[model samples]
Target: MSTIVFAFSIFCGWLIFDVVKHRKLTLESLVSSLVIAVVAGVFWWILDLFF
Candidate 1:
């Protein structure tokens, strides 16, 4: 479940960033998206482990 959530969050982050900046997906958006996604995923996973 956490893995699914992580993947979904990454997709959402990318979509939002792309929409806000370029109105479409771009290579630059992918880099930031991955970064945001990884950080968010790790945080979520840690929280899940605790609770």
Candidate 2:
């Protein structure tokens, strides 16, 4: 749970940085990256729990 939260937070920070640097946050990139990050985080959590 902590790992997932941390991963999501890091991804969100990266997204925010990109938005600030580009002066825009495209819907596609935002949604896609968010989804990817969430899925990756979940997987990481599961793996950590098992191993």
Candidate 3:
């Protein structure tokens, strides 16, 4: 479902950011991760709408 996809994207983004940033948990990474997640979710949503 779209909801699952969105949540998964968010989790993936967070995990990736955390892993790539030397495992350091910072506010900047957290914010950027959320942004990435939202963008990915919206992109997927649009694709779902069209196809």
Clashing pairs in 3: none
Q: Write the per-residue lDDT of candidate 2 for residues 1-51, one digit (tens) a residue.
A: 688687788679868877887799898768866876787788788889899
TM-score of each: 0.66, 0.58, 0.67
RMSD to the hidden true structure, all candidates: 2.1, 2.3, 2.4
1-51 in candidate 1: lDDT tens per residue? 876688677868676968787877777787777777777787788888898
Q: After superposition, how far is residue 33 of candidate 3 from its true place, in Å?
A: 0.4
Q: What lDDT, from 0 to 1, does candidate 2 have?
A: 0.79
Across residues 1-51, which tens digit of lDDT does each residue of candidate 3 receive? 875678677867786868686777777777777777777877888888898
In order, the Cα lDDT scores of the candidates are 0.77, 0.79, 0.75
- lDDT minimum window of 10 residues, candidate 1: 2-11
- lDDT for 7 in candidate 3 is 60
Give the count of colliding residue pairs in each prediction: 0, 0, 0
The alpha-carbon lDDT assigned to residue 44 of candidate 1 equals 83
Better of 1 and 3 by lDDT: 1
Q: Considering only N, C-alpha and C atoms within 3 Å, which residue pairs clash in candidate 1?
A: none
> How should the candidates be ordered by lDDT, best one leading?
2, 1, 3
